[model samples]
Target: MSKTIRMLNKDDYPQYEAMETGIEFDYIAHIFDRLATGDNHLYGLFLDGRLVSVGGYSIYAGSYAMLGRLRSDLRFKGNGFSTEVVSYILNEVFKLNGIRWVGANTQEHNTSAQRVLEKVGLNPYITLHGALTKDTAALESGAEPWQPVTSLQRKKDWLNQAYIRTGDIFPYECYYPFPASAELFQDEAIKQWSFYENDDKTRFVITKYDQKKYHYLHAVYPWHDLTSQPGLWETIASDYRKLLQQTDDETYIWMDLTKEEAQTLPASHQFELPSPWILYGKEN
Candidate 1:
């Protein structure tokens, strides 16, 4: 038996696309595009020159790295191939300069992947409830409209409060937790974080639109005081209603919260709550 792990290039896409990994990778073209632009690094592990496991990581904000797009051939399950590939990718990520933290997100129900992540020295950091809705009319309206926030200091302050509320990790995007720091706000090239706040300045959400990759409205909450704050859900719903009025795309919302906090969502709204996701990570 022989094993090899190395970087995968565009030429390897055919072999990657041919793998029967039992997973639907809709972002194959997106990942390859990023690889071409130097924003992504994909790696594959081979057994006797046969591709068995593959994974990739993306660096951002000049200080954070996110691991994702991991898939192993169904035939190679229970052989520790995922662990091998992940371990190798983790090593490769730290070899690059200026990476302070590395992390990955997985559904809470995926215990096997969790085990592999833990074996590679990553631990569960935070959990987020993924909720989505397409029925814009069901959401509440008439609340104060959301206004774009222009002050970087204000955005940083909001994230700081959320960081303290959620133990230190800031759930900044769909499945990525960033370390609480001021530097993350300084880099707009990695990600252009658009900040918004309600009329009274109590409710805040950070959003970005990527029609090709992320959903039309990708929202991350800055605070989790949902249940305690009156009219919180209504305000958020109003924000969604306003955004949906501009486009017909389905809206997706991610919030770092406990199961109890998630119940604060308005019962009338059409958001479907899926199995919560857990983010696993360790410092580089």
Candidate 2:
């Protein structure tokens, strides 16, 4: 028996597509195309010339990368092939220069994959519930105006509040939790940060266009303790509804909130809260 692992090229797509990932998400299904386009770094592990396991990573914000799309041939399960592929990919990635952080996301139910991720030093750092909404009718009547936030250097107090609310983790994208810091807020790629505030200007909402789906709106807001700020939900709902009107009917807004906040969402709102997803990461 012999095994070999190496970076995969576009020609490996057929074998990659043949593997049983058992994941139905559009992003998971289309990974090979992204890899072919140089958007991702993909690697494969072959046993005796047969492709058996695969894993990949994508760089974000020029300072960090995320591992994803790992899968194995269904027939080759139970032999720790997934672990081997992930560890091999991590070793190869770190050998390159200037990657400050690495992260990965997984569903809560994927215990096996979580074990593999942990074994490779990507420990669980944050978890969030995904809430998606498309109903315009649920729009609340009124709320405070959202002032565009171009920077956070002057808002030291607000940044502290955000850290307390989210444990120093900012839900930068739909499911990606990035370190909450003023330096990160300075990145040019994430200029869509905004805030809805009363006199104090403590509340914030950061919105970004989903890279994979043109019609999707990814928004994250760190409101400390929904119990004390029940009225904020109206602002959130109205914000989504107004944005929905500006886009095609198929467009939907996505928010990553705590499980408690998701469960407490007003029934009048049209958001669908799915199971919480876990984010794992390692800083180098």
Candidate 3:
């Protein structure tokens, strides 16, 4: 299918965003407004008069760039449109030098997307099982519960001390991969992190994302992994049950032992989707 692909001018943004928002069934107008005004770059593919595909880079300067909003109209999925969009986006990204790596993920069952990445020369790095959560169960695998917690209820179950109001870098120094991280995301459903120093600190965020399956790790740790040296799986499992008892809400953490580090997780620690989506990229 022949199409004209180009970077959107300021006037084209509203239409581009409209197409995206409609697909998401979401309205983060506030966050989208900031992107429209900021240093990000957006590219669109027009099939005649309609913007049929869209993608962009969220550059965070010296750190990393997040690959985001790579959406194509549902009506165009099987026509091999994504193959062209991914290549065009990479061509533009190669023009910049500071972007260390670009990363993205979809439901594990979305094999079509995996094929697209392979077709475009991007290789799989890691399948982070349970690394995602959603409002409605989007996971094709996992036994994560669907109960959303109330603000008051969260206060009672959460540790007594105040958690820092900032998002800390993940343990491996990975950031949100995009500026949208600045956007406050989803219902009262949020992940709050704090160091629990007390020996009595017992809880686990070891759950997974699955609308209809049990992809959760069935473990929890607050002060354990961060405070002490890496604790063995057996010892951690003992505290995980106590941690699990602390909350009435549903939660899950990453599973699967594809990497040497991940292999340390207990074999008994099961998941609904074990196929890993490797995260890897080259610096631009």
Candidate 4:
């Protein structure tokens, strides 16, 4: 008998939950449930009356929608189930015509999910800051405790190194949306960093963003500069200035500061919400 693809409605969630991991189940139940009853759409694949796969997204104020809670049962693996779900959502979302981008996030370890994303032709444009769970301070909204590290008093080198290996002292969601190899950051131009030594520990990490070339300026932690105590953040800034002086053109620089850092070295530069974001579509 052939497997049947079903238009999974909110009522079909229980069967869907059984086929997914706990996190996957809860995510679908909460997030997608809201979207389904509202303006969003949901779709699923059923084999022998069991829900094997599910996906969907919803649009908010923005022209595009976010793709989330996408999953298929492990037994259903290698069946192009994920590609099917993603394709279904894209087909629906693209029909609107004004949509620009579809955003989605998965754990760095979930290689399967990553392939599904690429197979569906969704571009990977973000290196989301990770969640700080261990050996770090919890961030209260509007609170930036990272000023000390940013200021670089004593342990700047050690912390910088840690950021590359473990992550920031704060925490971030690590990602490699494709099959990665022994060498990471193959395309990054700004691979090297040199640190500045100062008594104040008041330092700034000034990285230039090429609006023309939109890629992340990734930080390599354990800050392995050739010098035992080289100045990196400041050095990068100086280099950045040199490039600007040559080009005689200004570029955008986004600062991801801890609450303390923000309080201490808050940029005089004005900023606004980068962009309003949203998502929508049908899941296979």
Q: Cα lDDT of all candidates, in order?
A: 0.71, 0.70, 0.46, 0.46
How close to the true structure is residue 210 of candidate 1, measured as C-alpha lDDT?
40
Q: Ranking under TM-score, best-scoring first? A: 2, 1, 3, 4
TM-score for all models, in order of appearance: 0.82, 0.83, 0.49, 0.45
- In model 2, state the lDDT of residue 253: 71
Residue-wise lDDT of candidate 2 within 26-88, one digit each (tens)? Answer: 365565666745658888899988888988888766666788778888888899999999998
Best by TM-score: 2
| Candidate 3 runs further than 4 Å off | 17-24, 27-30, 61-63, 129-277
lDDT of 1 at 186: 61
Model 4 CA deviation exceeding 4 Å by range:
4-6, 20-25, 30-32, 130-284
Location of the lowest summed lDDT over 10 successive residues in candidate 1: 136-145
In angstroms, give how far residue 91 of model 4 lies from its true place.
1.1
As a whole number from 0 to 100, the lDDT of residue 169 in candidate 4 is: 26
The true-versus-predicted C-alpha distance at residue 92 of model 2, in Å, is 2.1
Off by over 4 Å in 1: 24-26, 29-37, 135-143, 146-148, 164-167, 187-203, 210-214, 227-242, 245-248, 251-257
The numbered model that scores best in lDDT is: 1
Candidate 3 C-alpha lDDT tens digits along 89-188: 7777766665545555544577777777677676554444433221212211232222223354453344222222333222221213221222222223
